[model samples]
Target: MEIADMFSTTTIPFSGITLEQVVLAVIIAVIGLIAVKVIASAFTEMLGRTSRLSALIIELLVRFFSILLYVILVLIVLATLGFDVSSVVLGLSAVIGLILGFGLQDTVTNLASGVWVAAFRPLDKGEYVEVNGISGTVTSVGILATELLKPDNTYITIPNSQVWGSAVINSTRMDTRRLEVKVGVAYDSDLTLAIRVATDLMKNDERVLPSPEPVVVVTELADSSVNLSLRAWTKTADLWGAQWDLNREIVNAFADAGIAIPFPQMDVHLDGTH
Candidate 1:
Protein backbone atom coordinates (compact mmCIF):
# COMPACT_ATOMS: atom_id res chain seq x y z
CA MET A 1 0.00 0.00 0.00
CA GLU A 2 2.84 2.40 0.90
CA ILE A 3 4.65 1.61 -2.33
CA ALA A 4 1.47 2.33 -4.33
CA ASP A 5 0.87 5.50 -2.36
CA MET A 6 4.34 6.74 -3.29
CA PHE A 7 3.33 6.77 -6.99
CA SER A 8 -0.21 8.05 -6.46
CA THR A 9 -1.25 11.36 -8.06
CA THR A 10 -2.40 13.92 -5.52
CA THR A 11 -3.51 17.55 -5.77
CA ILE A 12 -0.82 20.13 -4.89
CA PRO A 13 -1.87 22.58 -2.18
CA PHE A 14 -2.88 26.16 -2.98
CA SER A 15 -2.68 25.67 -6.80
CA GLY A 16 -5.12 23.85 -9.09
CA ILE A 17 -2.22 21.78 -10.52
CA THR A 18 -1.91 18.12 -9.58
CA LEU A 19 1.23 16.51 -8.03
CA GLU A 20 1.46 14.36 -11.19
CA GLN A 21 1.70 17.53 -13.29
CA VAL A 22 4.55 18.87 -11.18
CA VAL A 23 6.41 15.58 -11.50
CA LEU A 24 5.88 15.57 -15.28
CA ALA A 25 7.14 19.15 -15.51
CA VAL A 26 10.33 18.27 -13.61
CA ILE A 27 10.95 15.20 -15.79
CA ILE A 28 10.33 17.12 -18.99
CA ALA A 29 12.63 19.92 -17.88
CA VAL A 30 15.43 17.45 -17.22
CA ILE A 31 14.98 15.87 -20.65
CA GLY A 32 14.83 19.26 -22.30
CA LEU A 33 18.05 20.31 -20.58
CA ILE A 34 19.76 17.15 -21.84
CA ALA A 35 18.45 17.78 -25.34
CA VAL A 36 19.64 21.35 -25.22
CA LYS A 37 23.11 20.18 -24.19
CA VAL A 38 23.25 17.75 -27.10
CA ILE A 39 22.05 20.40 -29.55
CA ALA A 40 24.62 22.85 -28.27
CA SER A 41 27.40 20.30 -28.70
CA ALA A 42 26.37 19.55 -32.26
CA PHE A 43 26.14 23.22 -33.19
CA THR A 44 29.52 23.97 -31.61
CA GLU A 45 31.11 21.10 -33.51
CA MET A 46 29.65 22.35 -36.77
CA LEU A 47 30.95 25.84 -36.15
CA GLY A 48 34.36 24.46 -35.21
CA ARG A 49 34.61 22.68 -38.55
CA THR A 50 33.93 25.86 -40.48
CA SER A 51 37.28 27.53 -41.07
CA ARG A 52 35.83 30.93 -41.92
CA LEU A 53 33.97 31.44 -38.65
CA SER A 54 35.87 33.13 -35.85
CA ALA A 55 36.03 31.59 -32.38
CA LEU A 56 34.04 34.45 -30.82
CA ILE A 57 31.27 34.11 -33.39
CA ILE A 58 31.02 30.36 -32.86
CA GLU A 59 30.79 30.77 -29.10
CA LEU A 60 28.14 33.45 -29.37
CA LEU A 61 26.04 31.34 -31.73
CA VAL A 62 26.15 28.31 -29.47
CA ARG A 63 25.21 30.33 -26.39
CA PHE A 64 22.40 32.18 -28.14
CA PHE A 65 20.85 28.97 -29.48
CA SER A 66 21.17 27.21 -26.14
CA ILE A 67 19.45 30.04 -24.30
CA LEU A 68 16.65 30.23 -26.86
CA LEU A 69 16.06 26.49 -26.76
CA TYR A 70 15.98 26.40 -22.96
CA VAL A 71 13.63 29.35 -22.77
CA ILE A 72 11.22 27.61 -25.15
CA LEU A 73 11.49 24.40 -23.16
CA VAL A 74 10.70 26.27 -19.93
CA LEU A 75 7.63 27.89 -21.49
CA ILE A 76 6.40 24.49 -22.70
CA VAL A 77 6.85 23.01 -19.24
CA LEU A 78 5.05 25.93 -17.62
CA ALA A 79 2.14 25.76 -20.08
CA THR A 80 1.74 22.02 -19.48
CA LEU A 81 1.52 22.68 -15.73
CA GLY A 82 -1.52 24.94 -16.33
CA PHE A 83 0.27 28.29 -15.82
CA ASP A 84 -0.10 31.28 -18.13
CA VAL A 85 3.18 30.93 -20.06
CA SER A 86 2.44 33.95 -22.25
CA SER A 87 2.42 36.36 -19.33
CA VAL A 88 5.54 34.73 -17.92
CA VAL A 89 7.41 35.09 -21.17
CA LEU A 90 6.45 38.73 -21.52
CA GLY A 91 7.41 39.51 -17.94
CA LEU A 92 10.72 37.65 -18.28
CA SER A 93 11.53 39.53 -21.48
CA ALA A 94 10.91 42.87 -19.87
CA VAL A 95 12.84 42.01 -16.71
CA ILE A 96 15.73 40.51 -18.64
CA GLY A 97 15.94 43.57 -20.88
CA LEU A 98 16.04 45.89 -17.90
CA ILE A 99 18.56 43.72 -16.05
CA LEU A 100 20.83 43.45 -19.07
CA GLY A 101 20.62 47.15 -19.73
CA PHE A 102 21.43 48.13 -16.17
CA GLY A 103 23.52 45.35 -14.64
CA LEU A 104 25.16 43.66 -17.63
CA GLN A 105 25.97 46.74 -19.66
CA ASP A 106 29.67 45.88 -19.78
CA THR A 107 28.90 42.38 -20.99
CA VAL A 108 26.67 43.81 -23.71
CA THR A 109 29.37 46.26 -24.72
CA ASN A 110 31.95 43.46 -24.90
CA LEU A 111 29.63 41.34 -27.01
CA ALA A 112 29.06 44.23 -29.41
CA SER A 113 32.79 44.93 -29.60
CA GLY A 114 33.45 41.23 -30.13
CA VAL A 115 31.12 41.24 -33.10
CA TRP A 116 32.94 44.22 -34.52
CA VAL A 117 36.30 42.48 -34.04
CA ALA A 118 35.12 39.29 -35.75
CA ALA A 119 33.68 41.25 -38.66
CA PHE A 120 36.59 43.67 -39.14
CA ARG A 121 39.69 41.84 -38.06
CA PRO A 122 42.34 44.21 -36.78
CA LEU A 123 44.24 41.20 -35.46
CA ASP A 124 44.14 37.46 -36.09
CA LYS A 125 45.17 34.29 -34.25
CA GLY A 126 48.86 33.27 -34.42
CA GLU A 127 49.82 36.81 -35.42
CA TYR A 128 52.12 39.00 -33.32
CA VAL A 129 50.62 42.32 -32.34
CA GLU A 130 50.76 45.13 -29.83
CA VAL A 131 47.49 46.23 -28.26
CA ASN A 132 47.03 48.42 -25.20
CA GLY A 133 50.84 48.57 -24.77
CA ILE A 134 51.07 44.79 -24.35
CA SER A 135 52.81 42.97 -27.21
CA GLY A 136 52.32 39.26 -27.79
CA THR A 137 51.18 36.57 -30.21
CA VAL A 138 47.40 36.30 -30.30
CA THR A 139 46.09 32.84 -29.48
CA SER A 140 42.34 33.35 -29.71
CA VAL A 141 39.70 36.06 -29.86
CA GLY A 142 36.62 35.25 -27.80
CA ILE A 143 33.28 36.85 -27.01
CA LEU A 144 34.55 38.74 -24.00
CA ALA A 145 38.31 38.85 -24.35
CA THR A 146 41.36 38.31 -26.54
CA GLU A 147 43.99 35.84 -25.40
CA LEU A 148 47.67 36.45 -26.01
CA LEU A 149 50.69 34.23 -25.45
CA LYS A 150 53.59 36.38 -24.35
CA PRO A 151 57.24 35.76 -25.20
CA ASP A 152 57.72 34.14 -21.81
CA ASN A 153 54.80 31.78 -22.51
CA THR A 154 52.51 33.50 -20.03
CA TYR A 155 48.94 34.15 -21.12
CA ILE A 156 47.34 37.59 -21.13
CA THR A 157 43.62 38.26 -21.40
CA ILE A 158 42.41 41.65 -22.55
CA PRO A 159 38.73 42.56 -22.62
CA ASN A 160 37.24 42.87 -26.10
CA SER A 161 35.98 46.39 -25.44
CA GLN A 162 39.47 47.53 -24.43
CA VAL A 163 41.09 45.84 -27.38
CA TRP A 164 38.63 47.30 -29.86
CA GLY A 165 39.17 50.80 -28.50
CA SER A 166 42.97 50.69 -28.22
CA ALA A 167 45.68 51.08 -30.84
CA VAL A 168 46.66 47.88 -32.61
CA ILE A 169 50.04 47.37 -34.23
CA ASN A 170 50.42 44.26 -36.34
CA SER A 171 54.07 43.51 -37.08
CA THR A 172 53.57 40.47 -39.32
CA ARG A 173 51.36 42.05 -41.98
CA MET A 174 54.21 42.85 -44.37
CA ASP A 175 56.24 40.27 -46.31
CA THR A 176 59.51 42.16 -46.16
CA ARG A 177 60.90 44.39 -43.39
CA ARG A 178 63.64 46.96 -43.35
CA LEU A 179 66.42 46.60 -40.76
CA GLU A 180 68.42 49.63 -39.64
CA VAL A 181 71.78 49.27 -37.86
CA LYS A 182 73.89 52.22 -36.86
CA VAL A 183 77.57 51.95 -35.89
CA GLY A 184 79.91 54.78 -34.98
CA VAL A 185 83.45 54.72 -36.35
CA ALA A 186 86.48 56.68 -35.12
CA TYR A 187 86.90 60.07 -36.83
CA ASP A 188 90.36 58.98 -38.05
CA SER A 189 89.08 55.67 -39.49
CA ASP A 190 88.59 55.33 -43.26
CA LEU A 191 84.87 56.07 -43.68
CA THR A 192 84.95 54.51 -47.18
CA LEU A 193 86.38 51.25 -45.81
CA ALA A 194 83.79 51.13 -43.01
CA ILE A 195 80.93 51.61 -45.47
CA ARG A 196 82.30 48.90 -47.79
CA VAL A 197 82.75 46.41 -44.95
CA ALA A 198 79.18 46.99 -43.69
CA THR A 199 77.69 46.72 -47.21
CA ASP A 200 79.57 43.52 -48.03
CA LEU A 201 78.59 42.00 -44.72
CA MET A 202 74.92 42.67 -45.46
CA LYS A 203 75.17 41.39 -49.07
CA ASN A 204 76.80 38.14 -48.01
CA ASP A 205 73.93 37.33 -45.69
CA GLU A 206 71.59 34.94 -47.57
CA ARG A 207 68.71 36.13 -45.41
CA VAL A 208 69.02 39.67 -46.79
CA LEU A 209 67.03 40.40 -49.96
CA PRO A 210 69.08 41.39 -53.00
CA SER A 211 66.56 43.65 -54.76
CA PRO A 212 67.03 46.54 -52.31
CA GLU A 213 70.85 46.24 -52.49
CA PRO A 214 71.71 47.01 -48.82
CA VAL A 215 72.79 50.65 -48.43
CA VAL A 216 75.52 52.04 -46.15
CA VAL A 217 75.87 55.80 -45.73
CA VAL A 218 77.05 58.40 -43.21
CA THR A 219 74.00 59.50 -41.27
CA GLU A 220 75.66 61.80 -38.77
CA LEU A 221 79.07 63.19 -37.86
CA ALA A 222 79.26 63.44 -34.11
CA ASP A 223 81.83 65.22 -31.92
CA SER A 224 84.00 62.10 -31.56
CA SER A 225 82.91 59.81 -34.41
CA VAL A 226 81.04 59.40 -37.70
CA ASN A 227 77.91 57.22 -37.55
CA LEU A 228 77.33 54.93 -40.54
CA SER A 229 73.74 53.93 -41.10
CA LEU A 230 73.32 50.40 -42.51
CA ARG A 231 69.93 49.66 -43.99
CA ALA A 232 69.04 46.19 -45.33
CA TRP A 233 65.91 44.44 -46.50
CA THR A 234 65.01 40.91 -45.46
CA LYS A 235 61.95 38.66 -45.23
CA THR A 236 59.97 39.50 -42.11
CA ALA A 237 60.33 35.97 -40.76
CA ASP A 238 64.13 36.22 -40.94
CA LEU A 239 64.48 39.87 -39.85
CA TRP A 240 65.22 39.30 -36.16
CA GLY A 241 67.68 36.47 -36.65
CA ALA A 242 69.39 38.31 -39.50
CA GLN A 243 69.59 41.50 -37.47
CA TRP A 244 71.30 39.74 -34.54
CA ASP A 245 73.72 37.81 -36.76
CA LEU A 246 74.62 40.81 -38.92
CA ASN A 247 75.12 43.11 -35.97
CA ARG A 248 77.69 40.79 -34.37
CA GLU A 249 79.35 40.05 -37.68
CA ILE A 250 79.61 43.73 -38.60
CA VAL A 251 81.45 44.51 -35.33
CA ASN A 252 83.91 41.63 -35.90
CA ALA A 253 84.37 42.40 -39.60
CA PHE A 254 85.06 46.08 -38.82
CA ALA A 255 87.79 45.03 -36.37
CA ASP A 256 89.30 42.58 -38.86
CA ALA A 257 89.28 45.27 -41.62
CA GLY A 258 91.09 47.74 -39.30
CA ILE A 259 88.00 49.98 -39.11
CA ALA A 260 87.92 51.61 -35.72
CA ILE A 261 84.46 51.41 -34.07
CA PRO A 262 84.50 54.34 -31.70
CA PHE A 263 83.15 54.79 -28.18
CA PRO A 264 81.86 58.01 -26.61
CA GLN A 265 84.97 60.03 -25.71
CA MET A 266 85.29 63.72 -24.83
CA ASP A 267 88.66 65.37 -25.30
CA VAL A 268 89.21 68.47 -23.17
CA HIS A 269 92.32 70.61 -22.91
CA LEU A 270 92.43 71.68 -19.22
CA ASP A 271 90.32 74.83 -19.65
CA GLY A 272 92.43 77.41 -17.79
CA THR A 273 89.71 80.04 -18.44
CA HIS A 274 87.16 78.14 -16.40
Candidate 2:
Protein backbone atom coordinates (compact mmCIF):
# COMPACT_ATOMS: atom_id res chain seq x y z
CA MET A 1 0.00 0.00 0.00
CA GLU A 2 2.83 2.39 0.97
CA ILE A 3 4.78 1.63 -2.25
CA ALA A 4 1.65 2.20 -4.40
CA ASP A 5 0.90 5.51 -2.65
CA MET A 6 4.50 6.72 -3.10
CA PHE A 7 4.41 6.13 -6.86
CA SER A 8 1.06 7.86 -7.30
CA THR A 9 0.38 11.37 -8.75
CA THR A 10 -3.03 12.81 -9.63
CA THR A 11 -3.62 13.55 -13.32
CA ILE A 12 -4.14 17.26 -12.31
CA PRO A 13 -3.11 17.60 -8.68
CA PHE A 14 -2.90 20.52 -6.21
CA SER A 15 -4.35 23.44 -8.21
CA GLY A 16 -4.10 21.64 -11.58
CA ILE A 17 -0.41 21.87 -12.52
CA THR A 18 0.56 23.19 -16.02
CA LEU A 19 3.34 25.49 -17.32
CA GLU A 20 2.90 27.05 -13.88
CA GLN A 21 4.88 24.14 -12.45
CA VAL A 22 7.81 24.97 -14.75
CA VAL A 23 7.64 28.64 -13.69
CA LEU A 24 7.46 27.66 -10.02
CA ALA A 25 10.45 25.34 -10.40
CA VAL A 26 12.38 28.16 -12.01
CA ILE A 27 11.46 30.46 -9.13
CA ILE A 28 12.58 27.81 -6.64
CA ALA A 29 15.93 27.58 -8.42
CA VAL A 30 16.23 31.35 -8.25
CA ILE A 31 15.41 31.21 -4.56
CA GLY A 32 18.09 28.57 -4.11
CA LEU A 33 20.64 30.89 -5.74
CA ILE A 34 19.65 33.78 -3.48
CA ALA A 35 19.99 31.51 -0.46
CA VAL A 36 23.41 30.40 -1.66
CA LYS A 37 24.54 34.02 -1.88
CA VAL A 38 23.24 34.87 1.56
CA ILE A 39 24.87 31.78 3.06
CA ALA A 40 28.16 32.45 1.30
CA SER A 41 28.21 36.00 2.63
CA ALA A 42 27.54 34.80 6.14
CA PHE A 43 30.29 32.19 5.90
CA THR A 44 32.78 34.73 4.62
CA GLU A 45 31.97 37.22 7.36
CA MET A 46 32.24 34.54 10.06
CA LEU A 47 35.58 33.35 8.79
CA GLY A 48 36.95 36.85 8.19
CA ARG A 49 36.18 37.88 11.74
CA THR A 50 38.05 34.89 13.14
CA SER A 51 41.01 33.74 11.03
CA ARG A 52 42.33 35.55 7.91
CA LEU A 53 43.76 32.45 6.22
CA SER A 54 40.53 30.57 6.78
CA ALA A 55 38.58 33.50 5.37
CA LEU A 56 40.72 33.66 2.22
CA ILE A 57 40.41 29.91 1.59
CA ILE A 58 36.69 30.01 2.17
CA GLU A 59 36.24 32.96 -0.19
CA LEU A 60 38.00 31.14 -3.04
CA LEU A 61 36.18 27.90 -2.31
CA VAL A 62 32.83 29.65 -2.29
CA ARG A 63 33.36 30.99 -5.78
CA PHE A 64 34.25 27.55 -7.16
CA PHE A 65 31.39 25.83 -5.34
CA SER A 66 28.77 28.37 -6.39
CA ILE A 67 29.39 27.54 -10.05
CA LEU A 68 29.34 23.83 -9.23
CA LEU A 69 26.00 24.19 -7.48
CA TYR A 70 24.47 26.05 -10.41
CA VAL A 71 25.62 23.33 -12.81
CA ILE A 72 24.27 20.58 -10.58
CA LEU A 73 20.89 22.26 -10.25
CA VAL A 74 20.71 22.75 -14.05
CA LEU A 75 21.60 19.13 -14.63
CA ILE A 76 18.94 17.94 -12.20
CA VAL A 77 16.29 20.12 -13.88
CA LEU A 78 17.30 18.89 -17.37
CA ALA A 79 17.13 15.28 -16.16
CA THR A 80 13.62 15.89 -14.89
CA LEU A 81 12.71 16.83 -18.51
CA GLY A 82 13.86 13.36 -19.64
CA PHE A 83 17.04 14.63 -21.38
CA ASP A 84 20.29 12.59 -21.70
CA VAL A 85 22.27 14.71 -19.17
CA SER A 86 25.37 12.48 -19.01
CA SER A 87 26.08 12.71 -22.74
CA VAL A 88 25.23 16.39 -22.81
CA VAL A 89 27.57 17.19 -19.90
CA LEU A 90 30.41 15.14 -21.38
CA GLY A 91 30.12 16.94 -24.72
CA LEU A 92 29.82 20.37 -23.08
CA SER A 93 32.86 19.79 -20.82
CA ALA A 94 35.29 19.27 -23.69
CA VAL A 95 33.94 22.23 -25.68
CA ILE A 96 33.90 24.53 -22.63
CA GLY A 97 37.41 23.48 -21.56
CA LEU A 98 38.88 24.02 -25.04
CA ILE A 99 37.28 27.44 -25.35
CA LEU A 100 38.41 28.48 -21.89
CA GLY A 101 41.95 27.18 -22.37
CA PHE A 102 42.52 29.15 -25.55
CA GLY A 103 41.01 32.41 -24.30
CA LEU A 104 42.15 32.28 -20.69
CA GLN A 105 45.74 31.12 -20.93
CA ASP A 106 47.04 34.41 -19.47
CA THR A 107 44.43 34.34 -16.76
CA VAL A 108 45.49 30.83 -15.82
CA THR A 109 49.09 31.99 -15.63
CA ASN A 110 48.10 34.81 -13.27
CA LEU A 111 46.00 32.43 -11.22
CA ALA A 112 49.01 30.20 -10.71
CA SER A 113 51.13 33.21 -9.80
CA GLY A 114 48.47 34.54 -7.47
CA VAL A 115 48.44 31.29 -5.55
CA TRP A 116 52.18 31.47 -5.13
CA VAL A 117 52.02 35.11 -4.05
CA ALA A 118 49.42 34.39 -1.43
CA ALA A 119 51.50 31.55 -0.10
CA PHE A 120 54.90 33.22 -0.20
CA ARG A 121 53.94 36.88 0.53
CA PRO A 122 56.88 38.67 -1.11
CA LEU A 123 54.98 41.95 -0.79
CA ASP A 124 51.79 43.02 0.92
CA LYS A 125 49.24 45.66 0.02
CA GLY A 126 49.92 49.23 1.31
CA GLU A 127 53.71 48.81 1.47
CA TYR A 128 56.02 51.41 -0.10
CA VAL A 129 57.83 49.13 -2.49
CA GLU A 130 60.32 49.73 -5.27
CA VAL A 131 60.55 47.32 -8.19
CA ASN A 132 61.84 47.48 -11.77
CA GLY A 133 63.18 51.01 -11.21
CA ILE A 134 59.75 52.38 -10.28
CA SER A 135 59.14 53.48 -6.71
CA GLY A 136 55.58 53.51 -5.42
CA THR A 137 53.29 52.40 -2.65
CA VAL A 138 51.52 49.10 -3.30
CA THR A 139 47.80 49.86 -3.42
CA SER A 140 46.73 46.39 -4.40
CA VAL A 141 48.21 42.96 -5.11
CA GLY A 142 45.94 41.21 -7.56
CA ILE A 143 46.24 37.96 -9.50
CA LEU A 144 47.12 39.44 -12.92
CA ALA A 145 48.72 42.77 -11.99
CA THR A 146 49.81 44.90 -9.08
CA GLU A 147 48.47 48.43 -8.56
CA LEU A 148 50.85 51.08 -7.25
CA LEU A 149 50.30 54.64 -6.10
CA LYS A 150 53.18 56.84 -7.18
CA PRO A 151 54.62 59.76 -5.21
CA ASP A 152 52.83 62.22 -7.49
CA ASN A 153 49.48 60.54 -6.72
CA THR A 154 49.24 58.66 -10.02
CA TYR A 155 48.15 55.05 -10.26
CA ILE A 156 50.26 52.42 -12.02
CA THR A 157 49.51 48.83 -12.87
CA ILE A 158 52.28 46.30 -13.55
CA PRO A 159 51.97 42.69 -14.56
CA ASN A 160 52.71 40.10 -11.86
CA SER A 161 55.50 38.60 -13.93
CA GLN A 162 57.41 41.87 -13.88
CA VAL A 163 57.13 42.19 -10.12
CA TRP A 164 58.22 38.62 -9.36
CA GLY A 165 61.07 38.74 -11.86
CA SER A 166 63.03 41.56 -10.25
CA ALA A 167 64.43 42.57 -6.90
CA VAL A 168 61.71 44.01 -4.64
CA ILE A 169 62.81 46.84 -2.33
CA ASN A 170 60.63 47.51 0.69
CA SER A 171 61.56 50.93 2.04
CA THR A 172 59.43 51.19 5.16
CA ARG A 173 59.85 47.63 6.44
CA MET A 174 62.42 48.62 9.08
CA ASP A 175 62.17 51.08 11.95
CA THR A 176 65.47 52.90 11.40
CA ARG A 177 67.33 54.06 8.29
CA ARG A 178 70.52 56.02 7.69
CA LEU A 179 70.46 59.73 6.75
CA GLU A 180 73.36 61.47 4.93
CA VAL A 181 74.06 65.22 4.72
CA LYS A 182 77.05 67.12 3.35
CA VAL A 183 78.04 70.54 4.67
CA GLY A 184 80.80 72.73 3.25
CA VAL A 185 82.50 75.42 5.35
CA ALA A 186 84.98 78.06 4.14
CA TYR A 187 88.64 77.07 4.41
CA ASP A 188 89.26 80.20 6.51
CA SER A 189 86.64 79.12 9.10
CA ASP A 190 87.71 77.05 12.13
CA LEU A 191 87.46 73.37 11.11
CA THR A 192 87.29 72.31 14.76
CA LEU A 193 84.26 74.57 15.46
CA ALA A 194 82.44 73.39 12.23
CA ILE A 195 82.85 69.76 13.25
CA ARG A 196 81.70 70.52 16.76
CA VAL A 197 78.50 72.22 15.53
CA ALA A 198 77.55 69.39 13.12
CA THR A 199 78.33 66.72 15.71
CA ASP A 200 76.31 68.56 18.35
CA LEU A 201 73.27 68.76 16.02
CA MET A 202 73.13 64.95 15.69
CA LYS A 203 73.78 64.40 19.37
CA ASN A 204 70.93 66.71 20.39
CA ASP A 205 68.33 65.48 17.88
CA GLU A 206 65.79 63.19 19.59
CA ARG A 207 64.95 61.57 16.26
CA VAL A 208 68.55 60.39 15.66
CA LEU A 209 69.24 56.79 16.64
CA PRO A 210 72.33 56.22 18.81
CA SER A 211 73.29 52.52 18.67
CA PRO A 212 75.18 52.70 15.36
CA GLU A 213 75.57 56.40 16.19
CA PRO A 214 76.06 59.56 14.14
CA VAL A 215 79.21 60.24 12.08
CA VAL A 216 80.90 63.52 11.19
CA VAL A 217 83.96 63.33 8.96
CA VAL A 218 86.07 65.81 7.00
CA THR A 219 85.51 63.80 3.82
CA GLU A 220 87.21 66.06 1.27
CA LEU A 221 89.06 69.33 0.84
CA ALA A 222 87.81 71.05 -2.27
CA ASP A 223 89.25 74.16 -4.00
CA SER A 224 86.67 76.43 -2.36
CA SER A 225 86.07 74.78 1.01
CA VAL A 226 86.40 71.72 3.26
CA ASN A 227 83.40 69.36 2.78
CA LEU A 228 82.03 67.80 5.96
CA SER A 229 79.95 64.68 5.34
CA LEU A 230 77.46 64.02 8.13
CA ARG A 231 75.76 60.62 8.37
CA ALA A 232 73.25 59.59 11.05
CA TRP A 233 70.57 57.01 11.73
CA THR A 234 66.94 57.87 12.44
CA LYS A 235 63.54 56.27 12.50
CA THR A 236 62.23 55.65 8.99
CA ALA A 237 59.06 57.61 9.58
CA ASP A 238 61.04 60.52 10.96
CA LEU A 239 63.55 60.76 8.08
CA TRP A 240 62.19 63.79 6.27
CA GLY A 241 61.32 65.52 9.52
CA ALA A 242 64.80 64.93 10.93
CA GLN A 243 66.47 66.01 7.72
CA TRP A 244 64.53 69.28 7.64
CA ASP A 245 65.11 69.92 11.32
CA LEU A 246 68.80 69.09 11.11
CA ASN A 247 69.33 71.44 8.19
CA ARG A 248 67.48 74.25 9.97
CA GLU A 249 69.43 73.75 13.19
CA ILE A 250 72.76 73.57 11.40
CA VAL A 251 72.06 76.80 9.48
CA ASN A 252 71.01 78.67 12.65
CA ALA A 253 73.92 77.30 14.65
CA PHE A 254 76.43 78.28 11.97
CA ALA A 255 74.98 81.83 11.87
CA ASP A 256 75.06 82.15 15.69
CA ALA A 257 78.64 80.86 15.91
CA GLY A 258 79.80 83.19 13.09
CA ILE A 259 80.86 80.21 10.95
CA ALA A 260 81.10 80.71 7.19
CA ILE A 261 79.16 78.28 4.95
CA PRO A 262 81.27 78.41 1.79
CA PHE A 263 80.48 78.63 -1.91
CA PRO A 264 82.73 78.80 -4.98
CA GLN A 265 85.07 81.80 -4.71
CA MET A 266 86.63 82.57 -8.09
CA ASP A 267 89.47 85.14 -8.14
CA VAL A 268 89.91 86.85 -11.48
CA HIS A 269 92.78 89.36 -11.82
CA LEU A 270 91.62 89.81 -15.42
CA ASP A 271 93.36 86.71 -16.83
CA GLY A 272 95.57 88.60 -19.30
CA THR A 273 92.44 90.58 -20.38
CA HIS A 274 91.25 87.44 -22.32
Choose the strongest candidate by lDDT: 1
Measured against the true structure, the TM-scores of the candidates, in listed sequence, are 0.76, 0.65
* Residue-wise C-alpha lDDT for candidate 1, range 123-143, written one tens digit per residue: 888889999899999888887
Best by TM-score: 1
**Candidate 1 regions with alpha-carbon error over 4 angstroms:** 1-92
The local lDDT score (0 to 100) that residue 17 gets in candidate 1 is 81
Clashing pairs in 2: none
Instruction: State the weakest 10-residue window (summed lDDT) of model 1.
Output: 2-11
* Displacement of the residue 219 alpha carbon in candidate 1, Å: 3.2
User: Which residue segments of model 2 deviate by more than 4 Å?
Assistant: 1-106, 218-225, 264-274
